[model samples]
Target chain A: MKYYVCLMVVFLFSVQIQAQKVAVFDSYSDLEKAVLSDENTTYVVNFWATWCLPCVKELPYFEQLNSANKNLKVVLISLDFKNQYETKLLPFLKENNIKSEVVLLTDKDYNTWLSVVDKDWSGSIPATLVISKRKKKFVEKMFSDYEELNQYVNSIIN
Target chain B: MKKISVLLLFVAFIVTAAFTSIAPTPYKIGDVATDFKLKSVDGKMYSMSYYKKAKGFIVVFTCNHCPFAKKYEDRINDLAKNYKSQGYILLAINPNDPEVEPDDSYELMQQRAKEKGFVFPYLLDEGQKIYPQYGATKTPHVFLLDKNRVVKYIGAIDDNVDSAAEVKVKYLENAIAALENGKNPSPEMTKAIGCSIKSKK
Candidate 1:
């Protein structure tokens, strides 16, 4: 009976370790439902990859932005391979102490989803799309500092 | 004797200062090669029209910041060294927004050219207006133009970004070879991977 309890504890711990803190969505409908269900809320979706340097650099700024603005919903979508979810995604979130909802995008066709997100996006990482009630702005460029990001966010929010 | 030495030192400083301030003239491929009067690092003004009698030119958009651009720097030097004598002059252009990316500035461009031992002319595109005209989205984007200044090829240096052996297609080299041999290049356009050309607002 004691041995069974130990096994269960270890299994639960391992399961918790594998699950990432960020919410990942595999389908557009689910993502839309999560964001659109809240009418007054603004959603900031940042598409990033672990391998991309600019994406990694701008992550802290996004975290700061999310913490400061409680009313805004910030979603960090990791474009990392689905197979490497446990190996790459989970550890990155835990290590960074990322508080924002994180999710792994499972779509294989990049161009299709890229166009879906915003037609102006050139399929680049570190890309951000600000979705408000009836306005949307997409920036497909990399930001070197927090001020640059804040400027864009402020423009949309205001 | 002390006064004479001071005067000599001042003259040397003035000469060095003048040399450092010199910037190369910028130009885009597919456009008619303009007669640029910009000064070289050696304090000599070079004109593209002087080389108009040549077979063609290879215009490369590259910078110091991007790792992808750095990877092809040595290869670019080798290509320039090899082909410049064959009537093909390699003109490098730095089109990144200077305010945002200081490495693409005129002084840094000169410093990079000196450090890389670049034999080709590295020009600074100040406002970044010329990059988009040529449709250069990425660094190390090559534009191979014929004698008539028509764009013959636009794309990556090759298919392999990591290793030369893995390259299935040598786009720039193949285009140059075709131009030299009086043949139309096969697959004249291809997608290149590198940092986007930073544009000025």
Candidate 2:
């Protein structure tokens, strides 16, 4: 009937909207490999979480940068509690329409892996690491605007 | 009148120049920290001098809204309760600007302390001058000071943030234990993931 067709359309629309799947990284080395393996692309690895306000606020800038460029790979590493992945993280990703390659960092031993990420990083959220073949820079601060964010990325990529 | 005006301008320039030239440096390990008088949630003023008889102080820069701070609240409470009998004081300071994070206001700090049954003093850095002095970049950052007020250990509470049960290395506990034995704590500085302290620009 007509009513059945309308319900199916709504269901299909919902599925399509939430189609972006998030990759999970349980090991720090796996994530390290992912970052270093793609030599052709400049990796802008950002550590963030659903609970961190600054991280959520500046996400759009990264998404914008990802869409505007082809060589730049914006890897959004979610530090949200592993338990909240299904209930909180997935819903948030879908709601925000994030197009960047998202990954949930599932490492429990932070002390061991934090230094591996960046020696200068004091385990702060909204921190960014811009890595390319030529240079690498780690900043433990929030990017205020898109211009500032792009400047940091372009410096390494270009 | 022109000479007097010139003299006043010179004084003004000198004062501004002095302030700009001397930026406040944060205390590092082995440096003596200056005492600060801050208001607590219980409507009382507190300073490091207040706990004169104590061996050291566990100064935690934490806030209300940060989930990482919330996760460590009970552990902080436990540290205070267990260590209070052993001549140590745990002082929690909220350093995030309230305008940036409304939940971290003085009123909410009092509410959170009461709700969580915090036995220690929950103080507020009202003008936000104290945190930068200690070089605290994130919420739940801790600075352990000896009786001489020298910064002994600085950083996160532990290795595992989410679960306390499965924790292997208790960094804070180890630091306190080292101090109790008259020995310096190994791996004195540590890093843990935390929310950035909101600053009013």
Candidate 3:
């Protein structure tokens, strides 16, 4: 019985990534606190989920953006269900070697937050919100590739 | 850091905006949804015209692979099961192109309907033409129409995406009730996080 208990403990521990600091947001307004930065750094916030194929496809471009620039901040807001955070999300993150920050947003009331995120946003995954001190832009299209992603960021910064 | 002038930045921003912005849906509430013939899982072509006497239609732009759509599958089934006899038809359309998303292939859609015991017509939007016409942007998108083919309610099926048991706002059901009484559905349009419909940009 003790051996079985030890095995379960080990399994649970391995499920969570060691260094990734995942912030949990229950509401968009509450999330605004963390996203609303007054700093000089630009934040490339991508809302995604493990289930979205296009989201998963474009994720590497986001990673590229973060690694290429030291000053820019990349925040991945996962729309994955809270139940899948451990079983599916954590494992995927570890497998992909995700270096950017990941946030698990479990708020299911999308109608309330869609307008706030972007008045015209249709609440689609793989959506990006780029914010700097002077400007904030929301884009609904897929990044397509890393260059497109980088170019868009450059447009915002410059 | 070399700073670009604000005027130059604004021009670049405008160019980027063209690349970023998607074409907004031409549909608003009370718009008439066009009827189209699409092949269903049962190997039959179906259309809204066939259901001439249907009190309403819960035309869901859903697919086989979307996790959000999968989560709402049972709720959609329940909607068909309960409302079919009551003159409300659920036209479940797989709007995602199989070429772009192989998981939403016609064969898989048939398999999904069978396994899930779907009682409604699970149709395929062939040539990827139907969804754009209806302005459906994502899977599990609902466009409820009254008998006259006029769009009455558009958006999510419910408020909760995680679990059906915990759902507080039953948006589609309330809309159905409004239709029965010849009243406008409150909060006629809504939004929910869903997978973007796969197609050529």
Task: Tell me the DockQ of each model, to 2 decimals.
Answer: 0.07, 0.61, 0.66
Query: What TM-score does candidate 3 reach?
Result: 0.87
Residue-pair clash count for candidate 3: 0
Once all C-alphas are superposed, what RMSD does model 3 give against the true structure? 8.0
Clashing pairs in 3: none
Best by DockQ: 3
lDDT of 1 by residue, A1-158 (tens): 99999889866764574463555677655766765457677888888766555678889989788867786878888776565677987778777767677777765443245567776554446788888886778887777677878788888888
Which segments of candidate 2 are over 4 A away from where they belong?
A1-20, B1-23
Alpha-carbon local distance difference test for all models: 0.72, 0.88, 0.88
Tell me the chain A TM-score of model 1: 0.80
Tell me the deviation in Å of residue A55 in model 1: 4.4
Q: Candidate 1 or 3, higher DockQ?
A: 3
Ten-residue stretch with the least lDDT total in model 3 chain B:
B1-10
- Chain B alone, TM-score of each model? 0.77, 0.89, 0.87
Tens digits of per-residue lDDT, candidate 3, A59-94, equal: 999989997887789889999989888898888898
Write down the lDDT that model 2 would get. Answer: 0.88
- Report RMSD (Å) for each prediction in the order shown: 14.1, 6.9, 8.0
